[model samples]
Target: MSHARRLQRELQKMHQDVPVPGITMVNTENFTQWQMDIEVLDQNPIYHGKTFRLNFKFTENYPIEAPEVMFVRAIDREIPMHPHIYSNGVICLDLLSSGNGWSPVQSVESVCMSIQSMLTGNTKNERPRGDEQFVLGAGRSPRHIRFVYDDPTV
Candidate 1:
């Protein structure tokens, strides 16, 4: 299916289903770029009541290619401290990589669920090692970095 058609269907589906507590669509001004809000449902101190904003950039290849996703620094949306998430909002999950884990079968909802699960299971309140350096050295897009899937369980 065309990327535009598929995205429209996904948007419709997202509206039809009650969004998972903390995850809500933010912007749809243009199909190529979209934003969403994510909040960890658990009482994990690390996330507590913090709501995170995620930015997703889609290309024409779309599902065939993973969308570039990262957290956005907003008024109430702070980047979560996780071993896999950089201070610059770059996420290192394999699920978002086109290399091995990404699949056309996955949708925006599924990606949100996976990230929610990742945060719910995390116990650390630290950023990835060298977060300061990495954040300073990285490019604008997270897709340019080849992140190592160092850990399986968060």
Candidate 2:
């Protein structure tokens, strides 16, 4: 199916099915870009009671290519504290990487759940090493940066 059709189907399914816990679609006004709010449901102290916003940008090659996913700062939302999450909202999860882990079968819901899990399993209260230098030099889009997925333990 075309990318638009695939996205439409996913959107419809998200609306029709029971919503995933701790994951809520905040905005999906168009096919290209979407937003979601996610909370770490467990008692992870660093993320307790905090809601983080995620922004997904889809290209024409979506599904075939992974959508760009990142945490975004917004009203009442703060980026969760994780070693893999940058202060500027760039996420370093392999699930968002096309080369390391992304697959066409993954959907928005799955991505959110994966992130929620990533946060819940974390005990770190620090950002990635060299986060400041990286964020300053990084491109506006995560797709442009080749992230090294070296650490598996969050």
Candidate 3:
């Protein structure tokens, strides 16, 4: 199916199903770009009372290729602090990497839950090493950057 059709089906399912706790679909008007707000459901002190915004940009190649996903800072929203999350909102999760861990079966909701789990399990209250340099030199899309997912334990 075309990417647009697939997205439409996903959107319909999202509206029909009981919403996942701590995960809200903020914007889905555009199939090319969507936004979601995710909160760590657990009592992770570092992320308590915080909601992070995620921006997903889907390409025509969509499920065949992973959509570009990243944290976005907006009014009243700040990026969550995690060792794998950069200061600029670029994430270093293997699941977001097309070559490393992405699969055709993954959907927007699944990605949000995975990210929520990532934040919930994280105890470190800091950005990845060299965050400044990486953010300063990073390109507009996370797909262009080569992130080394060396540490499995966040």
Worst lDDT 10-window in candidate 2 = 138-147
Per-residue lDDT tens digits for candidate 3, residues 45-141, read 9999999999999999998899999999999799889999998899998888979589989999999999999999989999899999998998767
- Expressed as tens digits, the lDDT of each residue in 43-143 for candidate 2 is 88898888999999999999889999999888898887889988888998888887858999999899999999988888889999999998898776787
Candidate 2 TM-score over all chains jointly: 0.95
- Which consecutive 10 residues in model 1 have the weakest lDDT in total? 144-153
Local accuracy by lDDT, each model: 0.87, 0.89, 0.91
| Model 1, CA-based lDDT | 0.87
- The 10-residue segment with the lowest total lDDT in model 3: 144-153
Question: Order of all candidates by TM-score, from best down to worst?
Answer: 3, 2, 1
The whole-model C-alpha lDDT of candidate 2 against the native structure comes to 0.89
Per-residue lDDT of candidate 1, residues 26-125 (tens digit): 8966779899888899889999978888899999999889998898898878898999999888899989987887999998888988998899999999
What value does the lDDT take at residue 68 in candidate 3? 94
Which residue pairs does candidate 2 place in steric collision? none
- The regions of model 1 sitting more than 4 angstroms off are none
